[model samples]
Target: MPKRLTLTEAQQQMLDLPAELTNEPIIITKDGQPVMAAMSYEHLTSLLETLEILSDTEFAEKLRESMAQADRGETISWEDAQKQLGQ
Candidate 1:
């Protein structure tokens, strides 16, 4: 579960969170209602990238098709791929 903090507590302890805390966001609440989240820049960047991919209609369609193919066992083996690439 993520850490929760009130607005006042967030303001006071935002900078006190450990640097290694990256997996979960800090939930900021006002009057006990969640109003905001704080996460590492790296996590934000990753989320933005995922959103970008999801928003690209053509790419997302292709990705879905690829996943379906994978589910249907249409992929080649790693050795075959290496050989095809002359690696």
Candidate 2:
């Protein structure tokens, strides 16, 4: 889990961001309430990629349908797939 840092604690811990955000993000809070988060660039890029996929409704629907078909044991074999693709 990420570390929860208070405003003052976040200020004091700012220098530790390099190592702290390496493994997990930091939740920065203010006035005893959750406020924002600070994450590493790599983590942000990964999250952005996930967001991009999830945001594409058509692709997401196709993926969900494929998962449902797999759950029902409805699948195609490699040779059948190749044949279907006219390969």
Candidate 3:
């Protein structure tokens, strides 16, 4: 479960909370309404790494399709490509 703290209480406990619950997320609230959250650097990095892996998988699938088209002679040669680019 996420730890809950009022805005004022969060300000008071911010320093200690980081160390006390380094593996969990803390939810901060204003006027009893949820506003923001604080999580450990490790957790944030793990989330970013997962997102990168997912993006790479998508890119790889697209690259495979392009390669298949090229192998089937559906792609232009480098010289032709250069001419098309007016290079």
Which candidate number would show the highest lDDT if scored against the true structure? 2
Tens-place lDDT per residue, model 2, 1-87, is: 778989899899788777879888899999978899999999999999999998999999999999999999999999999999999
Instruction: Give the number of the best model, judged by TM-score.
Output: 1
Report the lDDT tens digits of candidate 3 across residue range 1-87: 888999899899978877956778888999999999888888889989877875897787887899899899898889999999999
Clashes of each: 0, 0, 0
Quality of model 2 by C-alpha lDDT:
0.92
Rank all candidate structures by their lDDT, best first, as comma-separated numbers: 2, 1, 3
Better of 2 and 3 by lDDT: 2
The Cα error of candidate 1 at residue 66, in Å, is 1.7
Candidate 3 clashes: the total is 0
After superposition, the stretches of candidate 2 with alpha carbons farther than 4 Å from their true spots are 75-87
Candidate 1 clash pair list: none
Question: In model 1, which runs have C-alpha deviations exceeding 4 angstroms?
Answer: 18-20, 85-87
By lDDT, the better pick of 1 and 3 is: 1
Tell me the TM-score of model 1. 0.79
| lDDT per residue (tens digit) for residues 1-87 in model 1 | 898989998788867765634787888899999999988888889999999999999999999999999999999999999999999
RMSD of each: 2.1, 2.4, 10.8
